[model samples]
Target: MRYLAGNPFSAVTLPATLAPEWSLQIERALAPELLRALRESLDAHCARPGDEAAQCRIARAAIGLMVDSGLRRAEAAGARRSGVKRVDGIRGQSMWTLTLVGKRSKVRTVPASPATLDALRAH
Candidate 1:
């Protein structure tokens, strides 16, 4: 989702925008198996009590994000530990944000659900 700076004199060669950008669309519903796996993982994460809780939370959050969101496997794997953020806006309301280095090293923010953030905070 980047455009070349349009500097003709520059030597670096790159495309103005990634191809197939217009095809982006969010699906109406998640697949049944994907939903099941997500719920199971999140549940297991919550059930594991003790010092390993953070690991479970990270695992569950990662899985929930991929199935619940559009992140790819590699993208999820590359998600930095410092990138998970909660932003407060109007009336002390907060929204979870997932920041990661996307394709081509593009840093982007994704809106995460309250449930996802709650799971993340549990650990």
Candidate 2:
């Protein structure tokens, strides 16, 4: 009898469609690690004495927000004050949540760590 099984070399049974074009879409974008480290360092620069008040606050706020949200740089820029909120969830844990528009017009909810709240308060 003829072989009943499919191609032995193939791992899947797909109909042979074109591979996904992630570059042309906003679904698969990611930030480079080196740039992220640089930005974090720059944000922390404000901790130095004699730093400009406004610039430092901006940096701190930016950095802390990113760290808290675990989002890319672009997402941080789209953050809005109106979307920030403090809520007490289970176990009486209170935290700040940020709602913002992400890539591909997706809306996401991001949490702010204590550090981020402090920075926002400072400004």
Candidate 3:
């Protein structure tokens, strides 16, 4: 409306009132106990040696990346072994990081837990 009104070859008027507002809904996160239970279940499934066990390992790694690193579904799915790197932290301690290509092809490095890295390696 503002652009049309500003145009010399057109006639338009902006509305006096503002647009209506809507409340945003947010979902609750799972409890820590529930997460622990889920990890235990996945671990149990992973212990069996078979094709299904292999799949369970992959699922466990993906879930660890998503939960611990806050990675999106697509980002977690796209993660690669080459992306995992060990870097020196401020305290001179070596730490693990995962490089991810997120939305819009933006690259980012996120800290990865040792357990998560182990899970990834197992897969």
Each prediction's RMSD over C-alphas, in Å, is: 8.4, 12.1, 9.1
List pairs with backbone clashes in candidate 1.
Answer: none
TM per candidate comes to 0.56, 0.59, 0.71
lDDT string, candidate 2, 6-123, tens digits: 7775776656333321222334434569547755675666666665756878877887777656667898988889989998989998888887777666677778888778788877
lDDT of 3 by residue, 1-123 (tens): 476656574566654543322321224556789989999999999999889999999899999987776677898888888999999988788999888677556676777899998998898
Q: Using lDDT as the measure, name the better of candidate 2 and candidate 3.
A: 3
Give Cα-based local distance difference scores for all models: 0.70, 0.72, 0.80
Residue-by-residue lDDT tens digits, candidate 1, 30-82: 77887888688668766877767667777777767775557777988887758
In candidate 1, stretches whose alpha carbon ends up further than 4 angstroms from where it belongs are 1-25, 32-37, 41-58, 90-92
The residue ranges of model 2 lying beyond 4 angstroms of the native Cα positions read 1-51
Error of 1 at 30 (Å): 3.1
Model 2 has an lDDT value of 0.72
